[model samples]
Each structure stands twice: as C-alpha cells, then as structure tokens.
Target: MDLNDLFMSCKKGDVNRVKQLVEQKEVELNVRDRWDSTPLYYACLCGHTNVVRYLLKSGARCEANTFDGERCVYGSLTPEIRNILVKDYV
Candidate 1:
C-alpha cells in the first residue's frame, strides 16, 4: 500500500528510514513505481551506493530489471561506486 513511500525513500536516499519501514512495516521491496522501476532499480539509477547497500542488506532483489535492461550496477554505477560495492564483498 505504501509503495510510493518506499519509492520516495529510495529517491531521497534515506537508507535508515527505508530500512525501518521495510523491516517494521513489511513493505514490498520489488514494487514498481509509475516509471516501472523498483526501489533497487531507482537506487542504482540514482547512483546511491549507500542506499543500494542498505537495500541489498535488507534483501532487496537486484535482479528486478528496469527499462534499460541493466542491473542497478550498469545504469548508475561507475568504477568508483564499483569499488565501494566490491569493498563490502571483501
């Protein structure tokens, strides 16, 4: 029901709020917005790596492809962001 709230949190890059809502309220992580983009996709499209990491930590599915046929990585990330993501893996 509060899909828009999820989307807006993604847009604003509010990682803490997003986490709280998703954890407490059980909001749908994969809900597509009017633009047909899930929160993970939008976070990637916006290049918000911290937000992306938070979402990923919360089990947001990155495989939810958006209009560009790219994972969140391909659309908004550069080598710099790649380093951040990779750091977490290491």
Candidate 2:
C-alpha cells in the first residue's frame, strides 16, 4: 500500500492491518504523511488504546508531538480515553 493508504488505516485504527503491514515491512512505521503524522500518532489521535499499545511495543514513538504541539498522548485523548489508556497501556 502507499503512504496515504497506510496513514488512512492508521487513522481508522486498523490494528490488525497496521501490524500486518508493519510486520511485512511494506510500510514504514515512522513515515510522515502530508500532515507530518506517523502511524502511531494517528492511532493515538483516534483513541485506539490497543493500537497504541501495539505500536508502542513495536517501537513507534510515543513522544511524537502534533503540528499544534500536543504530545501524541495528550493530542489524541479525552479525559475518559486518557483514563482508559493510563489503566491499560501506561
């Protein structure tokens, strides 16, 4: 898949597809899209805690801040989502 497709999948929180693509090495985990976003960033933005954990375990950077300067965690999370993530992934 192309970079945009990969980014779209990441934005959609397609954890299985993300893992498959990454494992196949067909997609670069750290590749930045037009908006300068990594797969992990999109996953976090969409509140995919499971995806976040998986990506983090796979070496996706947790501290990649957004264009507006919010850390990946803070940029993507609401209070409820953050709590869930803290409980599950942190």
Best model number under lDDT: 1
lDDT of 1 at 32: 75
Looking at model 2, residue 68 earns an lDDT score of 26
lDDT at position 70, candidate 1:
50
For candidate 1, the per-residue lDDT at 65 reads 42
What digit string (tens of lDDT, one per residue) describes model 2 on residues 13-49?
7888878888888886777877777777777778777
Q: Point out the worst 10-residue segment of candidate 2 by lDDT.
A: 61-70
Candidate 1 regions with alpha-carbon error over 4 angstroms: 64-69, 82-90
Q: lDDT (0-100) at residue 47 of candidate 2?
A: 77
